[model samples]
Target: MSIPFLAGAVSKLFLQFGCSEVRVEGLPAFVERLKGDRGVLTIANHISVVDEPTMWGVLPISTFYDQRTVRWTLGASDMMFNNTFDSWFFTKGQIIETFRGKGIYQKAIDTARAKLDEGRWIHIFPEGKIKQDTLTELRRFKWGVSRMLMESKGGRGEEAPLIIPIWIKGFEEVMNEEREFPRFLPRTGKKVTVIIGEPINDAIEPLLAEYQRKFPHPWVPITYGRDVQEDLKEEPPQLAEMRSKIAEAMRQELMKLGQRVPEVEAREPTKIEWNW
Candidate 1:
């Protein structure tokens, strides 16, 4: 069986056992807005490890715009691409393994650009890492998305990619990073809600301007690294400034989209124990 079909099948099974109900809002309108051969970039918040499979189950699999629009997503190389089975499964799901610390991330970006050139949808989690807090609390976004947008504009000009913001809720409740198996028979069935916001082609400028107004600084362009605990003391000032600005912009936009859903009381923290 093909990888996509396998993934779809597994996702469907998970939906049956893991999720009690799936609610998708604003998908029809977002799908209707897709036109021509323009590239689409979908951004969403990361809450749980099962978020990807949940998305695969809920989103329209093969019927986007009456054509099979290819989908591509980014996965951590060390986390998802190290084992043979994992590599195969993720690859079949169109996930491109990306090495976080290595300079190889540029390769992933190039691959994504190539796919976008072919009018495919690229999905990314701008938060870099999943948030362990409440559903309403969004972590700061990474600068990689802004860099992707800038690169796409430079390459595609007027046909630059369309950015779609999506907010997902309830995946964390089903299975968080701390759990290997989901609670199949919880008191309340798992319910996941996905809300897609309007598309925006001209987001960078406004987002950046708002970020600057909120946090004034003399900015410069810098490569934003993935690790939140990294010491920036040794980095060049300009690069650090630039990366911070871009990350701030992306975070603001995501926060705006996240506000569409009402905040819920913080779920009990997940406890993890390492056996090593």
Candidate 2:
């Protein structure tokens, strides 16, 4: 499916769900700052499954930017790219699948790096899972994004990638994990807000330190291989440590964005009345 077409469809779906008011902050200026072939990595809080498509629909339309720049998102293979239809849709939607158990997870990182090298945009949910509990609280972020950023910088030489932190509120009220689809008619006074923070160009060490201070327990390291022994062999002690630090740092950055914004109200959906 064409991106422009998908964007249109998602926009309509968002409207049908009573996404009446959408407010974007700090994204237009960031778009204007884009020069020739500069790569962008967007890190956002995952509130619902609709978060990805909502972002796709909202960003271009809200910013009045060109839709031709390919937007790549890293998604779980089992969840987002399970079947042929989903695979096809997500592929066209620019989702790069990350098969968790499969040894080829690195391939996804490499693919993202390649896209970034070509001056495209990549979106990652560093939190790794949807926060169905609350919009204010964020889950511990996984380390894939940090590793990806490091790899991208190494491949692109002097062209450093920009990391944009985004905070989206009201998606949980629109559609949570309990419902597969967004409500046909939204609750009264429901609004979706997407707040894009300024670009982060600093080193990852400080952010990583902050994350470690908050969550003292170390991140469970990821091992890649067909079997346990092979997995152990593939991941050395030092490399695993580095990856964990980077992942936490990325998570911290996203959590910081969430902190800056006001907490989204946790509302229980009321029973819908269908006029027969």
Candidate 3:
């Protein structure tokens, strides 16, 4: 399948913006992994806006094209969603919004199921927001990812979409600010690296057991009026500790599958948590 002309055009935009080389490797393995008639759900670390595009450049556009897997993206904010000029790449990449109201949660569930059925490649940041002023700790993984996967497994009766965790390094420097506004600053001498991890099954028995031991109750009929921020704040310290474990597991897995990065100068963050 020939790449859409826009792909090449977009490739140059990254180059023109001080992206010296968008290096791509492990494509053969990734292509082979996808050729088996399975959709993919990539959970990528959201550091900078450049993170996804760099991964897009490294990925085989032709394979993703043939699969008809629209690269779905979940933005961290309304502003991030609204400011995006590129909607041609995602199924509904505009805003990662979910409808609210009476009995509407099921609709959101159904939307996730339908996306998988369409054989689309969905991208989510498990953190749900970018980590600014902190690099050492990953925010807890939102239950939405686990919920979507569990629902998909039960609905399809086949292996769910291949879950790929991508660890992106160096974008924090390139974009270097909490929000998007600071990203456009004059380009400094910085480089970025994106490491793609191998796929995993979200419904694995061990993972479910792990969740049970941690969250205890899987489903509850809670009212909608409660603030979600308060709910998230209620998470136990165990959850945060467990989250770091999961993120490190994924990071290590990514490092194993990715290339040995060349020795490059990295701008260490003020606060750093070494994953290795």
Candidate 2 least-lDDT 10 residues: 267-276
Q: Write the per-residue lDDT of candidate 1 for residues 128-230, one digit (tens) a residue.
A: 8778687666776765665565445422233666777888888777665566444443223777677788775465555444434443542222544334334
Q: TM per model?
A: 0.73, 0.74, 0.63
Q: Which stretches of candidate 3 lie over 4 Å from their true place?
A: 1-8, 11-17, 21-25, 61-67, 80-96, 99-109, 132-136, 154-157, 178-189, 202-205, 208-276
- Across 111-150, the per-residue lDDT of candidate 2 in tens digits comes to 9877777787888887777887877777766656765665
Which tens-of-lDDT digit does each residue in 170-214 have in candidate 3? 667767665465556624445555555557554243454464566
- The candidate maximizing TM-score is 2
Backbone clash total for model 2 is 1
Q: Provide backbone clash counts, one per model.
A: 2, 1, 1
| Model 3 Cα shift for residue 260 (angstroms) | 7.0
Reference-based lDDT, each prediction: 0.62, 0.63, 0.51
Question: Cα lDDT for residue 121, model 3?
Answer: 64
